[model samples]
Target: MQPFWNFPATAGGTINSINNAGIETFRGNELDSLTREICQNSLDAVKDEEQPVIVEFKQFQISRNQFPQRDELVNAFNKCESTWKSKNTKIEQFVEQAKYILKNDQIPFLRISDFNTKGLEGARTGELGTPWSSLVREAGSSNKGDSSGGSFGIGKSAPFANSKLRTLFYSSYDITDYQSHIGVANIMSFEERPGFNTLGTGYFTDSHNSTAISNLLNLDPSFQRDETGTDIYVTAFEPKENWVEAIRNSVIYNFFITIWQDKLVVKIEDETISHENIGTLISKLDDDKEEYCQVKAYFKLLTSEEGIQVPYPAKRYKKIGEFKEGEATLYIMKGEDLNRRVLMTRKAGMRLFEQNRISGSISFTGILIIHGTHMNQVFKKMENPAHTEWEPNRYEEAPSEAKKAFSDLRKFIRETVQQQFQAETTETMDAFGVSDFLPDTTQVAGEGDEKKESLTMKIKSIAHKKKEKPKKKVKKKQQKENFEDTLEEVGITPEGDQAGHSNDDRNEGEGLGGGTGNQQGEQGPADEGTGGAKEGKGEKEKNKPIDVDTRYICLEKDSGLYRLNIKPEKKFEKGKLEFKVSGEQSDYILPVITVTSNDIEITSIDKNVVRFVNLTGKKPKNIQVQVDYEQYCVLEVDLYEI
Candidate 1:
């Protein structure tokens, strides 16, 4: 049968207008929304298991005559305008603009075509769960796989939002050789004739059942979905000036993992984002924003051959919520200018959100790739409509499990961050003193002899003018060494604030690769096919002293000596180095027998503090610290200003 525009009669039902909350959900972000949603849906519709699905976005202008039934749509717009001319401003304004856009002799269309996937099937039986019906005949509904990137089904509205005329055309040729096509217009309620009103939602199909056209509808010459896939034609496309770059960034931002894993490839205009060019694309995103930087970091983690794999049944926590089941890999790297948040992403490779539950005061970036069937099934339920955040309450199946899972995820993130970097600078100063962690110089015998040449010299250095930014507060109770608040009061701020900076130069991605060679394999063995044990809420978390980036610590064999090699990031004047020894279940100050430095001029050696002068940034300064204990145990050192 021939096709025509169909807006079913309301038949004295509740009147509707142009205020579509689903369409409005993507306001001001039409292009980004479209890119994210369209790509996510394609990822879910994967047909071949071994190959990647490809999505191509091509926009071109065609003469208005090329689009069939153009006059009929224009007539509908006229009726819509006349019916709500002065009755509703929003409807009136929308109709006026849509009518104006329709009057152009040359109409613009953005034809998005996808390949290497099953097309919109199930149209033959007109079934409810078919791809054709789910995408065309239905709204706010979906039947994707367990690990699909999308869940809310609201993503379908984003395409309409990109169209100035609020119209969209969907056509597909399924793997079964079945073909079907349909068009939908979301305008306002209007009167087709006297005393007869039609629905605001209109479809280009048979009036009786809204069945799609069985034959393929060629809307544009530049597009032809000859393969088993779907094509979305966004009419009256009003793309932004930087729409190309924006779309490129959005594709990478949302599906970097899929692209990097050879599961998805996106072609925009002349640029292709696949496993081959994925690295280069990620590099270009270095200057975009924090979110983009996160994308760059995530891409680096996914491509890198190293990271920690935390497997199912996370059984470490006692008080904190623990994961009873899941599959995930975590990669954390400490460096300059890292935003210090965990990138939580699903198997679909789309980033659900950046987690900042409790990062503590350590500068690092973490990526948690939650994959596998059981994990994705649980995690996807908590995802919001936009696939941006994890909303535990959104889980209708089991709210409690989802909430606990979310909490456990945060705990795991926080604990891993704390374990990787000694986030706790020192013990609570209220209960301890600096002298408690340091040895008494009067009790040592060599103190009287080294005092002859010790002369206190005042060090001169450049005074910084910028105000220091305070570190974030995190409450954690892991027992360890008691270094007190010395570093907290006089710690080095070598390079001013690092926020709003670039990390592309750090090459921080080196040690972050997972499932390969690493010096940290000896930490603790983990479940098969996963990373090792991370210390948190245990002994590993204790004795975590702040590590000075420019300093290195080592203990000599058959000697009571701990050598500290210091090379400041920026120049420093005069400072004191504190050395402490490991205590059973707790840490106390190791009594210093003697303090000596090769290049530094020692002003005085009091207890554990080695006050020195002229510690230049020109070269490394070697300081040999002598203690009474000969046996080697875990040791920690910190640098403080005099």
Candidate 2:
């Protein structure tokens, strides 16, 4: 049989290391690695066609008698040393376990097949462009074109790692020549014996002719279907229970973009899963409700034409210094339910940067598809072996043309994504009124104190006019000094009045006499005395003692709507001023309140008071109120201490 791991070694040394070296590159669960790797390989093998690539996953049981070349494999295991000369316990145990598994009448196998694609075809010399040799003989060799989805062939080890016996079979139908080829590989540990010692890895084919298999058509009847495709049979599949669901979820999670593009289709057993019925599949996968909704929203955005266009510069031709314009579509969604990430994809429909976490709790989830020939080329070169991220080191290691193009593209993507992230964060903050939470530190100087004094004088003049007789006018300077001195005596600085004055004061001054103007008339001396006493009393009421206690309220920043929370620091009588609110929506700002509250006192345009109703005959320490506003506007409620 043909042995790919036939590396030469000296005496008392390993002939070849057949363990899972490349398989360790996969970080998470085995099913995720398997789905990502296999699908990428299938995508890379797609021929030019309008039809999408179809992949199927199925499981079956095979008896020892049904295994192709079972006798040869059994003989090889029996002849190999149970333990290597170096005394490796894992090798000895693996050999014994494999022997036991092969002796059994029933064994589980997982078969993954793909249709409507170019099969592994070419010469058997392991050349750069030969798929047949590349699949069998090469470990990390790949010659895929720039638009291909996969670049590293090492992903082939994933299936082998999932198999308990570390054995898998490959069968492909070459469309160009209409010929079928089958090969099997078993990965074992290093072992040594007299005259029969070899590498732990070998193929199940004729020893005399390495390229021939025994009765390939009889091994599996599907091999004679006259279709150009590839089938992989993983023998002794481990963790057999619930494997179908695991694989289905992994496929959906990683390749959903491909499915959305109508470039790929997948099936597990009798059920066909695609983008059209992804909701049902998501339900079956037992995904979180928020995750399900976010995924659904993501697909909607991807399919619809609702995204921002981001344009950047790209290399034009072979000229040393020339660039052309290119554009990419960027879609962003903000919420706590969405996954916080930025998926970078190319025209081939392969996603990159799957593990990157964008810096924010805003949960910005979206994709940036960089289009155009020059841009795609630059991004494709940045992919590493695992196809998970775009490394910056590519720019420094590549040639001058690629180096410049990739550097520019990398910088463009970073800057564009950062700009979009910052913009979204700012928009979210504005929408949620985050800026209002900050402490107001603006110093109240000349103009502010003057404005406060002028407002106080206007209120007094309006109150006096409400009386029957007109009172003598006070000097503007004297009034201003008196107002400033009164504020200081009441433990409030002139600057403090300008900064901490509630909406009540401002509204009262603007709407003097509460929209009730005084009537002109003549009065007797008794009425005059009464009017003078009432005017003096109104002046005292204008400068009434207002106890100020301020507490910053924290709102839920995840959702669009925020419920107002109030925590008063002092107890109040029934008629005493409770609190005054600022930052309420204004009519000029496209009033978001479609329906006003029933209470006119609370919903009035001038000054509003939020009253609490005790339903259980108990007083609540704090109150929560919901404010309805337009989806785009921020609603912040500031509760002033009475």
Candidate 3:
């Protein structure tokens, strides 16, 4: 049993096929998947907390002869071809591509190396839970700890997926001073002789146990692992022209938080992405062309000092993992075009996904960073292999704990956002999934309790108390006139304020309740028309400007379709809606498909606008507008009399 490419005979005699599910899982994703998985693994092996772990991605070309054990691998491919001949199945097609690699004089290889990290550990220990074994030997299970980035070992197949020959080499010099290198080929199961079938997987090792060759690999003249790190050589690699940029974009997309915190550094070809250069790099990216379109906004929210940084207590939530009592921080940044999404991240700085379940009417961006070890472990267990999403059901230990932890997380975040960032009413709760949190206004009050106004109730114009002669303008009063519709409408009144509240100038919400004199409100003053001027007697009062508050609620009809519920303020008869998409630099470039109202006659105006020529007074209207973008968007609506 020499150290050679060995695919043991399928002694179990199970006939195998060419399809490697793990490899296929990563093959379709291309470099994005490759960068995400590899960088995550590199991040998990951080050797020093004080310094950032650096991962470099570079492409190299070498002579075909340099591929060790090349003859044996080619022979295996030929044998595989003959085993599945005449049917012209997938095995035949795979063999043809494998042969094409060896047919060329030059071999293209992508050599990915990482530094400032605990290279693959436990190479010589011949252990079950070693990093080397988890990658090369194990497939379904992982050796990652509770706080590591990845849980499934299937990520090891990403390198092979990128290789045209479906082969790759792994070499590591662990911090423990043990060095080893091995090659793995995931090809079709083939025949060694007339009737001898072997397993589809084969390894290039120095011994029979499939352990890596001890310190004997220099596949490329440019590759040298002098420091305590790992080097991966993706053999027969054929990558696209923008592979470097693609990989860099993926790194920023998936691990921006890690890079921003200086926990990780990435080098794609000549570009170096560190904490100091994070903003500059993010600024240059084309948001339209990138998958992590919100990366730029997210980075700004992370570094900005203006946002609210809330310390949420974890003890209030149900137990996850050890269930520590430490707290997590939730950042809230408000702006006009943030689109209102809170990205969820663990201590490792890898963002799991966006949490849009929290409902609000304001435009804001947020980041939920969980730094406690117990909570981090909990989230880690809930993440899929890509770590793009967190599913509590994935937590195998206790199903109820996972669900409870997830529920508690949403409750804490929603309550915090509703109390702080929410400006006026939850009526226009544009954010999805928080409908359950709202109070049902349809229910009647109990027999004893008088039916007071609910906070979510739409405010109607209240008749002002008539003053006798207005006291001849005795001391001009101060107030805010009518509060024209804007992002900030009014603050929520305290529950106690709702009871025994006056309908006179003391009205805090300004609820269209007529004001005859100066009255102070906790959120400022509610005044009359035109800069709080006192309404003059006689015909002068007729010149007062009409206070029209136009607000619309958005609901998702499908992927790109949004249904808007808007009520005209009784005065206007008809209007048009200018639909500008929510984008960076306030681009306002929404690709609108078609806008229609079931009862109203609507027509598309352009790529970002629509017009309805007919309307009824004070009637709530539903406009089904389909856009080319993802979800709910901030819009510019114009109402007019027809």
Query: All models: lDDT?
Result: 0.69, 0.53, 0.69
Compare candidates 2 and 3 on lDDT and give the better one: 3
Residue 409 lDDT, candidate 3, scale 0-100 = 77
Which parts of model 3 have CA positions greater than 4 angstroms off?
289-293, 316-322, 325-327, 424-560, 563-642
Task: Rank all candidate structures by their TM-score, best first, as comma-separated numbers.
Answer: 3, 1, 2
State the lDDT at 70 in candidate 2: 70
TM-score of 1: 0.65
Q: Please, what is the TM-score per model? A: 0.65, 0.60, 0.69
TM-score of 3: 0.69
The candidate 3 region of ten consecutive residues with least summed lDDT is 509-518
* Candidate 3 lDDT over residue span 83-128, tens digit each: 8897657778878988988878888899899898787777786588
lDDT of 2 by residue, 130-237 (tens): 886777666687777666766677787788777777777777766664444455554543334454445566665544334534222334434344577778888887
- In order of listing, the candidates' clash counts read 9, 1, 1
Candidate 1: lDDT of 33? Answer: 93
Off by over 4 Å in 2: 1-14, 26-28, 83-86, 123-129, 189-196, 207-209, 212-224, 283-294, 309-328, 333-340, 354-364, 371-374, 399-642
lDDT of 1 by residue, 1-642 (tens): 667888888889867788788899999998889998988888888899799999999888888877757788989988988888778998878878877877888899998989988988886767897777788777788888888887667899999999988899888888899988888988778998988999788888864678777877777776666788888889999876688888998888877877888989899988898999888878877674667777776666555555454543454333322444657777777766566777788888877778763443456777788776767777788888988888888777768767777786677776666666643546556655767865444645656665444448887987879977556333333332333443244442222211121112122211110011111211111111111112232322111112243322334534776654554443556655555543564444665678777678887664554556754654667667787677764554445433
Query: How does residue 58 of candidate 3 score in lDDT?
Result: 87
lDDT of 1: 0.69
Task: Give candidate 3's whole-model lDDT.
Answer: 0.69
Error of 2 at 442 (Å): 32
